[model samples]
Target: MIEVKNIEKSFGGNKILKGISTVFETGKTNLIIGQSGSGKTVLLKSLLGIHTPESGTISFDGRIYSELNPDEKRELRTEIGMVFQGSALFDSMTVAENVGFPLRMFTKDNNKKIQERVDFVLKRVDLTEAHKKLPSEISGGMQKRVAIARAIVNNPKYLFCDEPNSGLDPNTAILIDNLIREITEEYNITTVINTHDMNSVMEIGEKILFLKDGLKAWEGNKEEIFRTDNEAVVAFVYSSNLFKKVREAYLKE
Candidate 1:
C-alpha cells in the first residue's frame, strides 16, 4: 500500500499540489482523475518520487519516501514498476527481449533462467506465441500487454500506469483496463493509475481520488461517485456526451 499525507509542492512560485492526502490500497485499482493542469499529474509524479513534495510525506508500504537516502532510494526504485503512457516498448527488440529486459538489467541470472522468466511472463500476459515479434509487428493492445509483462517480470511491490489506455479505441481501452485489473489482483500489487477515462473509472476504480486544481476535492469508490453531490465532480462526470445520455436515462427510470 501507498499513502500520501498532507502533500504539498510548488514549481517556481506556483503551487502544483496542496495538502493532498489519500491512501492507495494494495491488490486494488487506485485511480487519480482530473482535467489538464488539475495536479493529478503532479500527485502521480510525487508518489513515484519523481517530484519531491515541498511539505508532506509519502510512504510506500512502510517506507517513508521523502527521507530515503540514495542507496535506499535505489532499493525503493527497484520495488516499483511503471507503465508509461505510450507502450514504450523498444521497437528493435523482440517481445521476449523486451519483457526480459528487467531481469537482464537487475539480475545476474544465467541465460536459461532469464529465458524461463521471460517465457513465464509472456504466457502470463497471453503473449506466448508472439515472443519473436517486434513492437511494430504487434497490435497496440499487444504492445501494451508486452509492456505490462515487462513491468511485472521483476515482481514489483508497486505498479504505476500513466494513462495506460490513452490513444486507443474504446474497445481496446477496456480490454487493457481488464488486463491490468486482473494482473493487479493476481499479484496483489499496489497499483495506481493516472487517467481521465470515465469508463475506466466505472470499470476498475476500487479506490478513486477526485482531484480539482491541486487539492483532493473528493474520494470514494465507483458506486458512490455517481451519487456524489459535489458540483465539480458532477460536472466532470456528466460533461461527456455519452455519460450525459446515460445520466438522463437513469434519471428517467
Candidate 2:
C-alpha cells in the first residue's frame, strides 16, 4: 500500500499539489482523476519520487520516501513498474527485447534466465506470438501489451500506469483496463493509475481520488460516484449526457 500525507508541491512558486492526503490500497486499482490542470500528474510523479514535495511524506508499505538513502532509493526504484502514456516501446527493438530491457539493466541474470522471464511475462500478457515483432510492426494494442509485459518483468511491488488506456478505441481501452486490474489482483501489487478516462474510472476504479484545482476534492469507489452529491464531482463526472443517463439509471435501480 501507498500513503500520502499532506504532500504539497510547487513549480516556480505555482503550487500544483495542495496538501493532498490519501491511501492507495494494495491488490486494487487506485486511480487519480481530475481536470487537465488539477495536478493529478504532479501527484503521481511525487509518488514515484520523481518530484520532491516541499512538505508531507509518502510511504510505500512502511518506508518513507524522503528518508531513504541514495542507494536505498535506487533499490526502491527497482521494485517499481511504470507503464507510460504512450506505451513507450522502442521502435527498433523486438517485443521480447523490450520486455527484457529492465531485467538486463537491473539484474545480473544471464541471457538464458532473462529470456525465460521475458517469455513468461509475454505469455502472461498474451503476447506470446508477437515476440519477434518490433513496435512499429504491431498494432497499438499489441504495443500496450508489450509495455505491460516489460513493466512486470521485474516483478515490482508497486505498479504505476499513466493513462494506460489513452489513444485506444473503447473496446481496446476496456480490455486494457481489465488486464491491468487482473494483474494487480493476481500479484497483490500496489497499483496506482493517473487517468482522465471516465470509462476506466467506472470499469476498474476500485479506489478513486478526485482532484480539483490542486486539492483532493473527493475520494471514493466506483459505486459511490453515482451516489455522490458533491457538486464538482457530479458536474465533472456527469458532464456528458451518456454518463448522466447512466447515473440516473443507477440511482433509479
Candidate 3:
C-alpha cells in the first residue's frame, strides 16, 4: 500500500496539489482521474518521486520516502515499475531484449537466467511468439503488452501507468485494462493508473480518486460514483449524454 499524507506541491506561484491525502490499497486497481489542469499528473509524478512535494510524506508500505537515505532510496526505486504513455518501448530492441533490459541492468543474472525470466514473463503476458519482433514490427496493442511485460519482468512490488490506454481502440483498451487488473491481483502489486478514460474507471476502478483543481474532490469506487451527490464528480463523470442517461437509468433502478 502507498499512503500520501497532506501532500502539497507548487511551481513558482502556481499551486498544483493542495494538501491532498489518500491511501492506495494493495492488490487493487487504483485510478486517479481529473481534467487537463486538475493536477492528476502532478500527483502521479509525486508518487513516482519525479517531483518532491514541499511538505508531506509519501510512505510505501510504511517506509517514509522522503526520509530514506541515498542507498535506501535507490533500493526502494528498484522495486518500482513504470509504464509510460504511448508504450515507450525501445524501437531498436527486440521484445525479449526489452523485457530483459532491467534484469541486465539490476541483476547479476547470466544470459541463460535472463532468457529464462524473459520467456516466463512473455508467456505471462501471452506474447511468447513475439520475442524476436521489434517494437516497430508489432501492432499498438502488442506494443503495450510488450511494455507491460518489461515492467513486470523484474517482479516489482508497485506498478504505475500513465495514460495506459491512450491511443488504442476501445476493444483493445478494454483488453489492456483487464490485463492490468489481472496482473495486479495475481502478483498483489499496488497498481496506480492515471487516466481520463471513463470506460476504464467503470471497468477496473477498485478505488477511484477524483481530483478537481488540485484537491481531491471525491474518492470512491465505481458503484459509489454512480450514486454520488458530489457536484464535481457528477459533472465530470456524466458530461456526456450517454453517461447522463446511464446514470439516470441506474438511479431509477
Candidate 4:
C-alpha cells in the first residue's frame, strides 16, 4: 500500500497539487480522475518520485520516502513499476528485449534467468507470440500489452499506470483495463492509475478519486459515484446523456 499525506506541489507562479492526501490500497485498482488541468499528472509524478512535494510525505508500504538514503531510494525505485501514457516502448528493441530490460539494468541475473522471467511475463500478458516483434510492428493494443509485460517483468510491488488504454478502440481499451486489474490482484501490487475515461471508471474503478481545480472533490467507489449527490462528481461523470441514463438505470435497480 502507498500512503500520501498533504502533498503540495507548485511551479514558479502556479500551484499544481494542493495538499492532497489519499491511500492507495494493495490488491486493488485505485483510480485518479480529473480534468486536464486538475493536477492529476503532477500528483502521479509526485508519487513516482519525479516531483518532490514541498510539504507532506509519501510512504510506500511503511517507509517514508523523504527519509530514504541514496542507495535505499534506488532500491525503492526498482520496486516501483510505471506504464506510461504512450505505451513508451523502445521502437528498436524486440518485445523480449524490452521486457527483460529492467532485469538487465537492475539486477546481476544471468541471461537464462532474465529470459525465463521475460517469457513468464509475456505469457502472462498473452503476448508469447509477439516476443520477436518490434513496437512498430505490433498494433497499438499489442504495444500496450508489451509495455505492461515490461513493467511487471521485475515483479514490482507498486504499479503505476498513466492512461494505460490511450489511443485504442473501446473493446481493446476494456481488454487492457481488465488485464491491469487482473495483474494487480494476481501480484497483490498497489496499483494506481490516472485516467480521464469514464468508461474505465464504471468498468474497473474499485476506488475512485475525483479531483477538480487541484482539490479532491470526492472519493468513493463506482456504486457510490452513481448514488452520490456531489454536484462536481455528478456533473463530470454524467456529462453525457448516455451515462446519465446509465446512472439513472443503475440507481433504479
Q: Residue-wise lDDT of candidate 3 within 1-253, one digit each (tens)?
A: 9999999999997999999999999999999999999999999999999999999999999999999998999899889988888888988999999999999999999999999999998998888899999999999988888899999999999999999999999999999999999999999999999999999998999999999999999999989999999999999999999899988998999
lDDT of 3 at 64: 97
Better of 3 and 4 by lDDT: 3
Misplaced by over 4 Å in model 3 are: none
TM-score of each: 0.94, 0.98, 0.97, 0.98
Q: What is the C-alpha lDDT of each candidate?
A: 0.90, 0.94, 0.95, 0.93
Better of 1 and 2 by TM-score: 2
lDDT of 1 by residue, 128-221 (tens): 8998988999988888889989999999999999999998899989988999999999999999999999999989999999999898999998
**lDDT per residue (tens digit) for residues 1-253 in model 2:** 9999999999999999999999999999999999999999999999999999999999999999999999999999999999999999988899999999999999999999999999999999888899899899998888888999999999999999999989998898998899999999999999999999999999999999999999999999999999999999999999999999999999999
- Cα misplacement distance, residue 122 of candidate 2 (Å): 0.8
Model 4 misplaced regions, further than 4 Å: none
Q: Candidate 3 has what TM-score?
A: 0.97
lDDT of 4 at 118: 94
Q: What's the distance in Å from true for residue 143, model 4?
A: 0.8
